[model samples]
Target: MADTIDEKTGTGRTEQIRDTSSSDRDFRLEEIDLNSNRDAKIKNPLAGIPHDALMRNVEDFAREREMTDLTDLLKKGAQIAQRPSEFETIEGLTDREREVLRDEVLHRWRQPKALYFTVILCSIGAAVQGWDQTGSNGANLSFPQEFGIPDTEFLDAAKTIPNPNFTHNLWLVGLINGAPYLASALLGCWISDPLNNFFGRRGVIFFSGIFCLLSVIGSGLSQNWWELFITRILLGIGMGSKASTIPIYAAENVPASIRGGLVMCWQLWTAFGIFLGFSANLAVQDVGRITWRLQLGSAFIPAIPLVIGIYYCPESPRWYMKKGMYRKAYNSYIRLRNDPVLAARDLYYVHAQLIEESHIIGKSSYLVRFVELFTIPRVRRATLASFTVMLAQQMCGINIIAFYSSSVFVQAGSSPRTALLASWGFGLVNFVFAFPAVWTIDTFGRRALLLFTFPNMAWTLLACGLCFYIPEDSKAHLGMIALFIFLFAAFYSPGEGPVPFTYSAEVFPLSHREVGMSWAVATCLFWAFVLSLTWPRMVAAMTPTGAFGFYAGLNVTALVMIFFWVPETKQRTLEELDYIFAVPTAKHMRYQANVAFPYFVQKYIVRNKNAKLEPLYQMDKNLAEGQARSASISEKP
Candidate 1:
């Protein structure tokens, strides 16, 4: 039995009992000398190191890798067991020293002081989106009066002469509410790809910040609807580019473990900006003619931090690699990561993936590549994933609350002052709920959160619609409606709010990331344009109950799409994701999930099937089998 255990372990016995059985001594299995049997499965490279010291190294490696699972532990252990030449660290050190040093540096890389600050800085672009949402929400309350809008029933009363321009007035309001979104969709979707390719992520952010700054100022100073509309168009262009650029920038810089949380900071800042925008609205609500103007212009404040802070940040190392600037990519990698060894390893994977992508695409024009995005199965899966997630986000009706919460409150029978205050409550709820997503995103995974929260959102929207059936002044009605609206925010914030952006950032390879994300964000802007242009008209025509009921139905569709189409992206390295997306599983998952439970399909259905038909899976299986057979023959000999 002892010889068999030793043989199975692929190690020789070094510590043996000397005739202890004759002396009535008990036999015990002693701890293996990890250093002696270098190829043994349970060997520890840092065997002689203090337990605390070894643990510290482990902790450091965990942080760099963003280690959240036992798989990470096993992988790291197997990696550490490799011989000196097999390691990615500096060549001179012994295997044990190299392992410990590699881990120490990885810890440093994970918590890099400058890189995190850079990520936060880039995320300010999202603050602009939030600021714009609430600013417009508040501004809409007062801007109508200044523009001769027939806001009250008195304008059509028998005693008063009817306004001839009421139709024109409503058109202008739709224009004002929707122009930025339209421009953002058109320009942001199309223009971001070229700008990102030509100038890089940091340059696009800086340019967008400037556009936001000038446009907000122009919006504030406008004397007529046209002036404000044109400025908003410019603002939309800036936001369009920024929205597409920031997430890519952050994802390219961080480790896969923390990448979801870090990229979600975009949503976090956006929530913060929403809270500030609402507060700004409340602060200037009594300023007479300038109240709406102040709200519109207050967005400029967040842009300053974005512009100043972006200058200090490094461009994505992947971007540098794509452009054939290897030295620059290496330097950026070093600056972004904790140690040169990890940097080298990460860069190696990035280069390999980029090369593979290039080989698959061959030498194609930008137009050809863009066209091929639809033609390639792997790339199309990513594109469709990004598009679907963005579509789901807009269809959920979260933006309806963000863009017109104040108006919804008024429609619910609250006074204008009460409506603005209630909007603030919505803003606070949005901000608070977003924090939990930062933790849950990387921990529980993306698909799980969407599956869990989307149903709550759909039901809550229905409840909100039901509230409109009650008498307007009743406390029960108002309280129930407000509770439902807040509940909708609670559900939307953690799931739809961050997932779309983070998921879009994840699905695309570096070669297509910029254009892919741009299109995804464009899809968001397009739907936002639809909702902004139609919501008021929908409410006026169908009543708030019918309008919200429509939104609830859309949420149901979104839930179906998410359950069927979206794959779990948590814990995967960006390069590794290339392989996963290449598999023809998304369509199969969608079909199976539509037929049954998605969780069961993911856990049991997919794993249980033999994948040996696929060439890659077949090759891997054959190679593994061959190795096992060879090992058995050697053992027999």
Candidate 2:
């Protein structure tokens, strides 16, 4: 063991012993002197730079290292052979891999896992909104007893009977049901933008969950209608704020490839929450007066995951980038994109866009930012598109079905128990149908879905109105009404229900996204308030038939507006769509059906032989070429 251990040191030990004849020539720690003054003067050199700048440097170093590694690998064979092959020089990847990598760098491929967990966590905010809406539907069945309204009067009244509080009670029900949206339309519209600016997208959503929890508790524990109304208003503030913020938040964090599907998860999860609410309602239906309390309180359950889970989620990189927190944005962008190359590429684009936006809206106040949405030609057109989609969504009257499902089923000639069961079925169908939009929204195109589904919903709603006109109530009549209602869910869920929120989120640029979306959500809340506040009176005055007929006609108007104004936003990057809305609204609207729509049909379909679409395609080609020429000329100066 000694011989083996000493064998390697034998020659070195002899040389050291020979050289140690003079100890002054020996190595010593003292000989290697430290500059004490210099060290003392600079205790922590990193402290001289701002934290954000330091972080940006770190990110830049990491990105450079990645690039260096890629460059070295690509040049390795060429350097050794002194001759670079075309195939070998393609970014350290094979031809097929290079193509895929190029697509990823361009942000074209679907990447779900990287952002899925975070997006789903954010979607719980939407679920909270749905829970409040549908849970209240079940709660309305029983809350009247606690509030001094008779079980068999007003909403539950089998036959019209004279009651002292009939008109007052009906209005009170409308107020209670519509209070959240009223608060959302008023208070929420004002707060959502400022809160988003001050606290960021995630922070506002976090606060929304807190508001939901506390307000739900207040609502469930209310001793009187006034108390419940106030709490419901608070709850509305939370829901309304979420409506405006969550979609943009999710959209900014996700890749544009899966953006529509992920953002539409807002509605998808809301439907899930509604299903939970209806199930909760069914569970407690026999619990006497406490049934309503349990139903209302159940909204708090989803708020738990929302508040707790959101902390683990990263803030939007675009939000950080907008605030000039480059390091934070880079870090977040990296975390959100698993591919380092793709992350670096997307971060660069975000930086470029921020600079462009700053140039465009220099020193503009927040109010001016909103005004520019109406005054700037491109932004104004986009606003109109967003506004119409949101308005159309609400005008489709899905909320009427959600808020008054119990009453509608009761009016359709079902017993109270049977009506409650039917409400559960409606909630299930609503939840299940939303899954299709997850697949179709990114595939079939938003404009097509809206155009096709609106007519089906209108016809189904018309049939529902016709069903109520049957003089004698029969199983066939009830079944027909139920079928129409189901069909409405089937059509609306995949199209109008999810598309509006997704579309509105997409059209607005980063600078005005929050305020723009807030306006859109305000439109939704306004219509929600309108429908909720007036439905009882409308049903009382016009009968259910005329009420549904009004909604049917509204759907038709929505269909027309969508066809004329809304552009197809399938498979396009968020920034790439600027030109689509840049044209004058008057010109586009005048020629859309005659010139644009046919070209869309020809390009997306009829690829082999299509003479009917040729003229339309040529017209569109000329229009686009002319616009490009004018833009280039304008820029040349």
- Which pairs clash in model 1? 109-338
Question: How would you encode candidate 1's per-residue C-alpha lDDT over 1-637 as one tens digit per residue?
Answer: 0111132354443222111112111221222221121212221122233434433544443343333333233233323322222344423445654554444324323467768888779667788878977788888888778866644422122123436654455556766888888998988657888887778889999989999888998898889878888999999999889998898899998877578989888888888889889999988999898999999999899888888889789889888766655456667877786655556556544543453455454444567667867887777778877888999988999888888888788777778888899999989999999999888998798888898888899899999999888886688877888999999999888998889989998888776788788888899988898888777656665677888999899988988887766766775667656655665654446444454464355557688453332112211222234334434543552
- My TM-score estimates for the predictions, one after another, are 0.78, 0.80
Q: Each candidate: RMSD to true structure?
A: 15.1, 16.7
TM-score leader: 2
Q: Tens digit of lDDT per residue, candidate 2, span 458-544?
A: 999999988876653566877788889989998988999889888888787777788889888888888898888888767766778
Over 4 Å off, model 1: 1-110, 153-168, 585-587, 594-637
Assess candidate 1 and give its lDDT: 0.71
Backbone Cα, N, C clashes tallied per candidate: 1, 0
